[model samples]
Structures are given as structure tokens and as C-alpha cells.
Target: MIRDIFENAYAAGAYSLAGVVLMAISFLVLDLLTPGKLRQHLWADRNRNAGILVASNLAGIAIIVTAAIVASDGRLVEGLTYTAVYTIIGIAVMAVTFALIDVATPGRLGELMLHPEPHPAVWVQSVAHVGVSLIVAAAIL
Candidate 1:
């Protein structure tokens, strides 16, 4: 019984590690899309727009990871695979959406990332991230 418990714990840890890696990758993707270093904007500058966008991106990744784990049905290998693939897809879609929104708008989206004030464009992009994640999660199910 103890061995079974330990094995389950190991599986859980594996899934969690996979989720963390995927989340970090998503952050990098967002950092590349925005202006300046994300850490500087988020930590030193304390930019609300960057914070909102990063928060939404992380939440979206969590949604995708959760859906993948649930759909895995206790299969560790399959769960990790699904989580990684879905996360990559989610990131790609979010990047493309960001680009499209930038082209459709007046000024540069990257410029807005460091605007120091709350911007409607940031909120729209945030919603887009979460919305795309939901769509990807639903597809996983």
C-alpha cells in the first residue's frame, strides 16, 4: 500500500513538473512578444499591463494543463505528452492572435506593454489569451 502511494505521489510530481515547464515556456513566448525584458517590466517597473498579460497567460496555461491531466485518465506518459502539445499549440495561437491584434490596431502592441498605465488593449489581449486557452482545453476534452 505504501509503495502504491509513493508511486502515485511520483506521478503527481511528474505531472506538476511538466506543467511548470510548459508555463515557463509560455512566459518566454509572451516575453518575446512584448517590449523589454518581462522580468524588468514586471518586477522593477511594476507595470500593470505586463502583470495582467502575464497573469492571464499563466492562467491559460494552467487551464490547458488541467484539462490535459483530466483527460489523461491516470496515464502519466500520455498526460505529459498531451500537456506539452496542447501548451505549444496554445502558445502559438496566442502569439498569432497578438500579432493580428497589433496589425489591426493603430500603435504597436509591444509599445503598449510598457505604457505604465492600464490600457484597454492589454485587457483585450489578456482575454484573448484566456479565451484561446479555453478553446484549446475544450479540444483536449
Candidate 2:
């Protein structure tokens, strides 16, 4: 039974990780396209926003874990439903994270993260998110 639970969690985690990757790519592309003022307003202080992003990613992982626990029986329909729900939740979390960064920062989010400025902290947070997502995915699969 424990093994079954772990397996379900792993599967859920995999789907959640995939969703996170897609969202990250979309965010990076959007940031690249946005102009200066807007960028500054959205994501100026990488330091301040990095933590929030990490927190959001953690929240997403937690949701996946919960779903996995709930669907440990390996019911195909339930698993699919959980995946869809978790993906939607992840997207919502990403949106909220973006909004929070936009509200807290100065100019535009895209411009700020793209200004050739080196923000190791931001990168670290992003990497952490990716790692967590991957772990979750592995648990699910």
C-alpha cells in the first residue's frame, strides 16, 4: 500500500513538473518580448521576487503531493482528473506569482529579468522550482 501511494505520487509529480517547465518557458519568452518600463515595473528586484517564485513552486509541489495521496489506488480516471486539476492549479499559481512580482517591482517584469543583469538568486530559485517539479514527476510516474 505504501509503495502504491509512492507510485501515485511519483506519477502526479511528473505531470506537475512538465506543467512547470512549460510555464517557465512561456514566462521567459514573455519577459524577453516585453519593453523596458513595463519590465522594470514587473520584475525589477530579482532578490525580492525570487523567494515568492520559489514559494509558489513549493505550493504547486505540495498540491501534486496531495493529489497523489488521494489517487494512490491508481484509478485511471481519477489520476487523469488529478493531473488536470493540478496542472490548472500550477498555472494559477504561476499567474499569481507573476502578478505579485509585477505589483511589487518597478517598471516591467520582462525588462527587469532580461537586462543582462546577473541575478544568481533568481536563477537559483528557478532551478529549485525545476528540481522540485522533477522530483514530484518522478514520484508520480
Candidate 3:
């Protein structure tokens, strides 16, 4: 029983670490797609558009990770692999979505993130991120 407990704890820890790493990757992806320094905009400037976009990206990652973990069904290796793969796919899709939006819209998407006022486009992009994540998550299941 104790061995089983230890194994479960280890699995949980591993999954958690994987989730955090994937989230970091997602953050970097978003940072790359946005203009200026993301940290500066998020921390010092406290830009609401950047904040909303980032929050949605992270939440999308969480949703993907959760779905991957659930689909693993107690298989650690498979879970980690799926989590990473799905998260990467999610990030790529989100980036492409951003690019598409930029093309279809009036101004540069990345530059708009730096705007002082909250832009409606940012909200649309944020929803797209979560929507793509949900599709990926559903695929995992």
C-alpha cells in the first residue's frame, strides 16, 4: 500500500513538473508573437491587453494539460508525451491563428498588444487560443 502511495505521488510530481514546463513554453511562444518585451508589458507597464492575452494562453495550456493527463489513464510515460505533444500543437495553432488574424485585421497584431486601451481584437484572439486548446484537448480524449 505504501509503495502504491509512493508511486502515485511520484506520478503526480512528474505530471506537475511537465505541466509547468509546458506552460513556460507556452509563455515563450506568446512572448515571441507579441511586440516589445512581454515581461515589461506584463509587469512594469501592466498592459491589460497583454495581460488578458497571456491569461488566456496560460489557461488554454492548462486545459490541454488536464485533458492529456486524464487521457493517460495512469500511464506516466504516455501522459508526459501526450501532454508535451498536444501543448506544442496548441501553441503552434495559436500562433498561426494570430498570424491569420493579423492578416485579416487592419493593424499588426503584435503591435496592437502594446496599445494602451483594451482592444476588441485582443479579446477575439484570446478566445481563439482557448478555442484551439479545447479542440486539441478533445482530440486527446
Candidate 4:
């Protein structure tokens, strides 16, 4: 029984990881394909630091999705409702957390997320998003 559970969890985690990789690649491609005008207004011109910020946000989403998938134990059909709920909750939590962190640290978070700097906050937010996703996924499951 224990072995089975572990195997299931491993499978789920692997699935989730693949999803994360796909999402990251997709976002990167989209960023590359985006027009200079829209990109400037939405991402570049605003702060000239949109790349990392956008990447971090995308990374956070991937983490949340992964957590939800892992929490579902690979039972996507059965866990559809749980995944949706957890995704919503995870997004909300991440938004709030980012807001608070931004307020507390000023441009620090933005610099790391928006700029090309290595921001620990990105990891922190990703972890939190994943954690919340897992909780909500588990509750629904």
C-alpha cells in the first residue's frame, strides 16, 4: 500500500513537472513573438524590466498548476473540480502575497521579477502559490 501510494505520487509529480516545463516554454515563445509596440507598452516601456517579471509570474502559475496536479494524484478526470478550485485560490493567494511583498520591499520584488536580477522573492511566491494549490487541491480531492 505504501509503495503504491509513493508510486502514484511520483507519477503525479512527474506529470506536473512536464506541465510546468511546457508552460514555461510556451510563455517564453509568446514573449518572443510579441510585437514590439504591445510589448513596450505592456512590458518593456513601462519599466524596461518586464522580462523577468513576466517570467516569474509565469513560473508561479506553473508551480501552482504543478502542485494542483500532484495533489490530484494523477486522477485528472476525477480531480477536475479540485484543480479548478485550487488554481483559483492559489492565484488569489499569490496576488495578495506579491502585493504585500511589494509594499514591504518597495522596488526590490519588482526588480527581481521585472528585471534580470536574481530575486529570491520569486521563489518565495512560487512556493507559496504551490503550497496553497496543494491545500486547495487536497481539500477538494
Q: Residue-pair clashes per candidate, as listed? A: 0, 26, 0, 2
lDDT of 4 at 103: 77
Instruction: List pairs with backbone clashes in candidate 4.
Output: 49-114, 53-113
lDDT of 2 by residue, 7-111 (tens): 768876765675466445445543444444333534564434434444545555555645554554656556656665554544454445555665676766544
lDDT of 4 by residue, 69-106 (tens): 65666575544444455555655665566667667875
For each candidate, what TM-score against the reference? 0.96, 0.43, 0.96, 0.45
lDDT of each: 0.92, 0.52, 0.93, 0.54
TM-score of 3: 0.96
Superposition TM-score, candidate 1 onto the true structure: 0.96
Off by over 4 Å in 4: 1-48, 107-141
Worst lDDT 10-window in candidate 4 = 29-38
Residue pairs in collision within model 1? none
